[model samples]
Target: MSSPPAHPALSCAGLAFAWPDGTPVLDGLNLAVGPGRTGLVGRNGSGKSTLLKLLAGELAPTAGTVRAAGGVGHLPQDAALDTRLRVDEALGVAGTRAALHAIESGDVREEHFAAVGDDWDVEERARATLDRLGLDRIGLDRTTGEVSGGECVLLRLAALLLARPAVLLLDEPTNNLDRHARRRLYAAVDAWPGVLVVASHDRELLERVDRVAELRGGELTWYGGPYSAYEEAVAAEQEAAERTVRAAGSDVRRQRRELAEAQARLAKRRRYGEKQAANKVVPPIVAGGLKRAAQVSAGRHRAVHAERLDRARERLEEAVEAVRDDDAIRVELPHTAVPPGRDVLLLRDLELRHGARIDGEFEVRGPERIALVGRNGSGKSTLLRTIAGEVEPRAGEAAARVPLRFLPQRLDVLDDGLTVVENVARFAPGATPNRVRARLARFLFRGAEADRPAGTLSGGERFRATLAALLLAEPAPQLLMLDEPTNNLDAASVRSLVQALEGYEGALLVAGHDVPFLEAIGITRTLDMDALTSPRGAT
Candidate 1:
């Protein structure tokens, strides 16, 4: 493999940032990024996006400095263009295109030639870039609002590629992309030769990076190679950390034992001296000297053991911190179980919005785990909402036979103004606050985290809170339908979702493009929405 560049393309020193409310997000953060792709990952709310913003000069640090080799290009988290602008304008080639067209005509203006400047093939390059990013079908004259959100992201990146920025910062670039768009972005990352830093949760995207930069507790930790390599290294480190903790724990216990034994021995010596003096074995002066010497020795001995025990405890604390196993979600929903031969869902001749139709009857029986897979704008979310009774089908009927809950792609299942506990309680009216908190704790939202307003939560935290509310509902969701469940979730939250599903014995219908995540959750059947909605489609 080629080594990283010798000189830094982007670097920051003693970087710090804080919210207006005085809550510090990042402090004394230092990073030096050279050539090649780097994937920045961490649990949600680790300030990865904030770091990218600082690097791109979108946000000024409360302290410290940022330096770069040349002009930096940044793709914002919510990248978009004015709906009225043409595709060429969004790609940053409108002016050049106009100039070239003017020169092509009989005008032959000097200013037009100057505007074109050596970039005579600008239109060709722009079209090529758009095609490379899976925008081949989207013509240059198309309006910005005509494309999907995912395509808009690609368009922004295409513009950057055409601009030829010295450094690029992509924040969750794949969050809005579909599988096809994501594949194109992966190819773009592979072809990029300059400094590229991407903050992403997509496993496939992280696997393409040359290095992994993890932001945890405001510190940057670097790992060589791809996502798998980083996981291996972390696993090995955690094993070593646990071993160190075990050894330190044993040492602390041993020190305590030894200290107790020494105290016992000192007490025995004092008792023997007193007994001898009482029995007149030594004169008064000799007895007094013996007692003073024993007192001094016992004091020193106990102090030594006490100090050793303190040191051992401190080591144990340090070792525990080194281990990286954060708290995981381990909720078991026995109440959500559906026995075999149960009819969980039924959809007969359903015609959803956007002219999508399921012409035949469809049924989900027992504890089936079905995956709804499709491209962007393929009506996956619409189908899920139809089944949940949130949206009316244009024709026919959709019904859920069992008690069910739907987790929409937006994760808008909770009341934003309410605390997490209160939201869960909203779904379970009879449950007490303590009972709600007890259930939330299983989803890793314990103590103050459970009391925090849902609006204040990170994306991952919001998912957890929504999940807690769903699974802990009164009748228990026997059929759970989730739409694009893994979007914008960190790796830890994904794992937590997997864990939650592992213990849930219910019918599940999850619509998403994350195939690996579907596999992880043990998807037993796959249904393609495109095939389901075609003219010859069936149940």
Candidate 2:
């Protein structure tokens, strides 16, 4: 007799899923997530979000079984909490707490007693959970609208924690969170007791995981340790794959040379046989027999060389396929360079209606990179808009001496109806389509991909297209202002963006909550919008 297999915290066997249009996302996938923190990573459009939805029971798989030891809680990439929902209601304990209050007030209905059965300290637990998630000051009666977008995300996570599910799934939990909120969420992840699976591009978040699971082309590959370890492993694997490809390429070349040599020798032998046959150096029957034997020998030799060449070519193809193609953006903008002493932007006591208060003068000169950091609703976006000339400041002057462009958080610069090529052309009207396409190719939109409609592109691809438009515009922008640029980008796209920025020689003002990304892009200084607005309680 054999013992039964142990059940993991969560398991999926031969799972398959497809979109409504019959486009497959995951096919015949098998996964087992034991009790621990696991980081799920992949490129955009790789179905990380869809997989979480299936596991959370929000969507049914097209095939196979998904089993979990206990309840599952999932936080999606876009956690949309109703603005009017109260804190206690969002935590899922409003009914029970209300019942407790009613019972204490001498309204002892049987239903009220039933609602308040065993868990009488629900409010205490809710508050504790909220506190653990860094919402200590938040009142249970307050509505979600009173909090920031980052706070709303943490609030949802607190509710999930209150549920105490056996398995938790978080998708891009740190997307809009500021540094402080992200640190609190990281602590929560570190302290989670159940099977926690997070799909994120945040390097710091991934660093806390016990293991990394990479999903590529509908397949799951498990790597022990954190994101850094996974990157090292991947690098080693790529090195080996490249070596194999080189060896296979050499084998193919050798086989081709051997085949050519055999063909040449065979042709020479045929010519010799023809001459001997014509010279009548032997009897007619002997010459015929000799000619036939030589022909058979040459045919066998040629067939063997041809077969070896075919096999070599196949091996080379397989070797090449094993390597991952990480297409990166390559940009060169000499026109965007600003001299060291040149004034790029000047702001004089700019103030916005939304509590973003800049009481003093600020100027950006040369190729300086500045990070605009603040809590959500602190008017970082408003400040960027004012400098971009999209919004007028109420009390002061916001001016840009050099040519400037703004990349909004919502990516509104693009026209969804038009293709990416058309969008670039709109920004660079003087450039021909061929020239625009050639420039777009550097941003990794090669050939037909450049012709894709902006609406049809994935989040990362759309970012790239928007970036291409900005960089390829007429009289290239000397000052680039980006509002929460890394909000929805995948890790690969983030790296590509950094590389593009490295090539740019302009002044940068990027407002974002991603600290690692800011550091990676070489931010020279930081302006805290929260400090500027603290005196007025604006946000």
Pick the TM-score winner: 1
Q: lDDT scores for all predictions?
A: 0.84, 0.84
Off-target runs (Cα >4 Å) in candidate 1 are: 1-6, 76-86, 94-120, 143-149, 176-180, 331-355, 363-367, 385-404, 410-439, 447-457, 469-479, 502-506, 532-539
User: What's each prediction's clash count?
Assistant: 0, 0
Give the C-alpha miss distance for residue 331 in model 2, angstroms. 5.4
Q: Considering summed lDDT, which 10 consecutive residues are worst modelled in model 2?
A: 1-10
TM-score of 1: 0.84
lDDT of 2 by residue, 157-195 (tens): 999999999999999898768888888999999999999
Q: Candidate 2: which stretches are off by over 4 Å?
A: 1-6, 20-23, 60-65, 330-356, 364-368, 374-382, 385-405, 410-459, 465-478, 513-516, 519-522, 533-539
**TM-score of candidate 2 to 2 decimals:** 0.83
